[model samples]
Target chain A: MMRRYLVGLILIGLAFALFPLLRQAGVAEAPGPLASAYLENSADDFGAANVVTAIVVSYRGFDTLGEVAVLFAATAGVGTLLTRRRLGKAVPPPGRQGGTEVLETASRLLAGLLIMFGAYIFIHGHLTPGGGFQGGVVVAVALLLGLLAKPDAQVSHRVMTTLESLSGAVYVGLGLLGIVLAGGFLDPRALPLGVVGQLFSAGSIPLIYSMIGLKVGAELSGIIDALKGDRS
Target chain B: MMLEIAIIVAGVLMVGIAIATILTRSLLVSVIMSGGVSLLASLVFLLMGAPDVAMTEAVIGSGLTTVVFLYALSRAKQPDDEDAAALASPPGDDTDGGQP
Candidate 1:
């Protein structure tokens, strides 16, 4: 207890000491160089009204690929760690008797809306605040709710793994197409840059983000399944 | 001024929750309180105008993590219960406090 208190106090003091430094950092009222550049060039170059989507899917596309790879590796690692042999007897299955009727009905009712919302978020990512990662997580939450409502319900491993691999392959293929047809890899300009502020205007950005959303959603659902030990 | 006060209050509440999480004996309670801390921190993030990050933190940190912790806790308790059952059953079988 004493050590914890001491550590807490030290952390508080460190935070206080850093506060002034943060304030003195001369926070910019406008976007930084990279942000400003993206903002200026997004419409002309990528035909995306949302500068953030342009940056994420085109300007810094390689970084996003790396992020996806990291997530994939983490999911694989968790799957290995929680293998049935390592876990011994399965952890007695959650909600063995099934959740209450109210829970089941509510989740069933909400699941479709949640999925639609997630789709909307990722589909309109190039024009909205959300993107692949955020929308993917929302989709995962919907699946999680289904799991909670019906523990015995099985999410087909084959389907999830297939979706994961297929999305990843398509994402890579899109990048290669960019190299062949456009300036460089993951170039949104590979396709026709339609009118700005339209759904299909961002060339391949929305497509790529949609693929990313599917890939992320599949990977996260796989991880949840592995953790839940629902090999059946 | 009102926003500043709100931020300060949230910060204080987060700190208090952190302390409470550390001090709590019940692992489940601690997990829940840590979720509370995430909730408060996300509020602060929203106040600071990072709605994206705030949403992520609230959903992933406070929501999913808490559920995961509870699942893990339930799994962990089983082994201890089995160990206790094994210990108790042997004593009853021995009938004389295992003096045989």
Candidate 2:
């Protein structure tokens, strides 16, 4: 009786909370002044046709740096918690042989395509709707798929750690280069801004975003590897 | 007009799925329903002209989160020494085994 009443109360409260948001649904509004300015100048200023990419990688990159740090910390925490030192060799592999034949075959075929798609997303991030984070997730998903397929394949922790460290260092180094050679930290203008829509046009935005993609991919793979537990 | 109706239907379905996710006693069902909620939300986002957000929600929210939860569930220990129950039950309940 108590539980039912509590649930009812919570539902009522949620309804009340969502009512105002519901009222605003389907109502279109013009962009605010800040948005208008960003839209107007981002292409010219950042040499990136995708304004969101400009903002994420250059206009407000410190916040992105912090977000990457947070992801790194989370990966580190998961690794520390689930590794062989902490958890003994009690839990065995759920699948003794591997994934089913169909799964293994399908993932084997899809993995290459998935990786290529992820690379394309991050590389074209400066000109398109997607960016490093989404691309990184796709890459991590590919790694996860491969793990699901093979189950006993050796994932080199050394390689993952090295890639993660190198990418993170490159991101920060580029930020420092921005401060030294351009307007501020992570300024896309650190290098020459070429034509707005070209591949090499965004002046290090693509480079920085690629680093971010690699870093995020490696970090997420580390977390997944940790969770896979004592496969060795 | 059609878009608005589609969005409304998606929103209502999300609410229904959310309720189902909470009300389910089985953890595996709950986790899957949670993923369903994300999948619906991604559709809603795509309708709302935010494909980037929709992709993120679909991949991370619906895809990776489900896999991670299943891993954690598989790692969790059972109460007593019927080790087969843990392995046999498929992480939630092969035969309604979230019981005392």
Candidate 3:
């Protein structure tokens, strides 16, 4: 305990000592050339009103592809580590009483709205501040709410796996189409860049992001379901 | 000026909550305080004109993280009501020098 305090004190002292260096990086106002380029060209190039979405879905799409794979691996790792077989013995819940009537009713009332809201966010990825990752997590949160309200809820692993796999395959297929029909891999220009700022714009970016959202939502829900250890 | 002051206040609150989170005896309090820190930080992110990051921080960092931590805490080692009350009794000054 004494060693822990000592280590913590040393860390705090080091942090204060390093605080002066922060001033040097705090005053930059203008976007750099690379940032400026992306901001300027994203709407025109991909019809994504949101520059960040364009970058994530089109400009550096390969990175997003890799990130999706990493999320997949993490979900898989969690699923394997906390297998249904392992949880079958049941470390009995700590006197967790069932949800109140109000709680269950509220969750039921709210779940549909949340699911639609999540889809809307992903569908408007090109024009909004949010995209696949945020939208996907929102969907997972809906699932979580439902689970908490009804602890015995069972999410079919087969359905989740199939959805995730299909979305992932279609995402990759879209990228391959970009290679053949457009400039390079994951190019949004493969389809015509519709009117900018419109719902139907951004060429393939919205489609790719929708796929990513479904894939991420399915992956995260699977992880949550596995963690809850239901459906044995 | 209002934005600047708000940012400063939120930043200070975050720092205090972070310290409290680390020093709290109860794991539940620690998780809650950390969530408070994230919630304040998300407000700061919004003030800094990054709505995208702010949204993510609020939803994931604050909401989901707190829920996940509570789940893990419940599953890991659940102290009884008496034990929790005992932990929450001491506040600012660590009478036992940070360890029971």
Candidate 4:
């Protein structure tokens, strides 16, 4: 216990020491190529209203691709950890399920609204602060509500796998298309940047975000499904 | 400035909750408190201006993970209450076998 307490204090001290460093990074204005070029060609080249989205989906698209793979790996990990036969035997019996009926009914009404909002966030990612990741998670929350209210609810693995695989393939194919057309990967300009700041602008960004939304939604649903399936 | 302070406080809360979860005897309480740790960490990320990470943590760490932990906890057996009851009675108090 003493050792653990000492470590905790050390961590708190380190956090305080690093606070200034993080603040400096956020506030400092450096007239460097990275910053200027980012500001200069982002919206003009990508036609994205959100500069950060432009950078993520275009300037460093490959990194974003890797990030998606990481999420996939995490989803796979938890599934394997809890579901693998090698770990241990299944739970003896399923758990009971009952919550306030009013909350359940409220969740039912809210689920649709959440799904719609998620789709909107996914579609308008290039034009707004939200993006595929946020939107996809929102969709996942809706499915979670079903699991809570109905213990017997089961998500179709076939449908989830199909959605996950197809969305990932499409995202990669779009990137490859950018390489073919623009002589480099993830060049939004390769797909004819529509009028700047418009909803349909940002070429393939909206398309990519839509695919990401689909993929993340499917992946999270699969995870939740697997967790619920192991209730027995 | 306030946001930074909030982040610091949240980080402290998270570490405290993590310690509490580890030290707690009851599995159910540990799982619930761990969820609190995740929620605090997500809020800290949000206060630090990384809304994307905040969203992921909020969804996965606090939401899905907590439910999964609760399910797993229910599957585990409690230390036998019968042992405690046995300890309550003295071993030499077997009057039924005194005649034998």
Highest TM-score model number:
3
Stronger candidate by TM-score (2 vs 3):
3
Leading candidate by lDDT: 2
- For residues A39-156, what per-residue lDDT tens digits would candidate 1 score against the true structure? 7888999898877778889989999999999999999998888765555544353446878899999998898899888889899988877778878888888888899898878898
**Model 2 over residues B1-100: C-alpha lDDT tens digits?**
8887999999999999999987777778888999999999999999988777887899889988898887776666432232334454333222123222
User: Model 2 captures what fraction of native contacts?
Assistant: 0.29
Off by over 4 Å in 2: A1-28, A93-95, A99-109, B77-100
True contacts kept of each: 0.10, 0.29, 0.18, 0.20
Residue-level lDDT tens digits of model 2 in A1-232: 9998999999999999999888977465887798899889998898999888888888889989999999999999998777564465434645578778899889978988888898899999988878788899889889888988887777888999999999999999999999999998898799999998999888989999999999998998888778776466
Number of the top DockQ candidate:
2
Q: Compute the lDDT of residue A97 as modeled in candidate 2.
A: 81
Clash number for each model: 0, 0, 0, 0
| Model 4 agreement with the true structure over A78-131: per-residue lDDT tens digits | 788655353343333335566577877887888899899999988998887778
lDDT for each of the candidates? 0.82, 0.84, 0.83, 0.77
Residue pairs with backbone overlap in model 4: none
Error of 2 at A136 (Å): 0.8
Q: List the residue pairs that clash in candidate 2.
A: none
Model 3 Cα lDDT, one tens digit per residue, A55-95: 88988999999999999999999878766444343343458
Ranking by lDDT: 2, 3, 1, 4
Looking at model 1 chain A, which ten-residue stretch has the lowest summed lDDT? A86-95
DockQ of 3: 0.16
Of candidates 2 and 1, the better by DockQ: 2
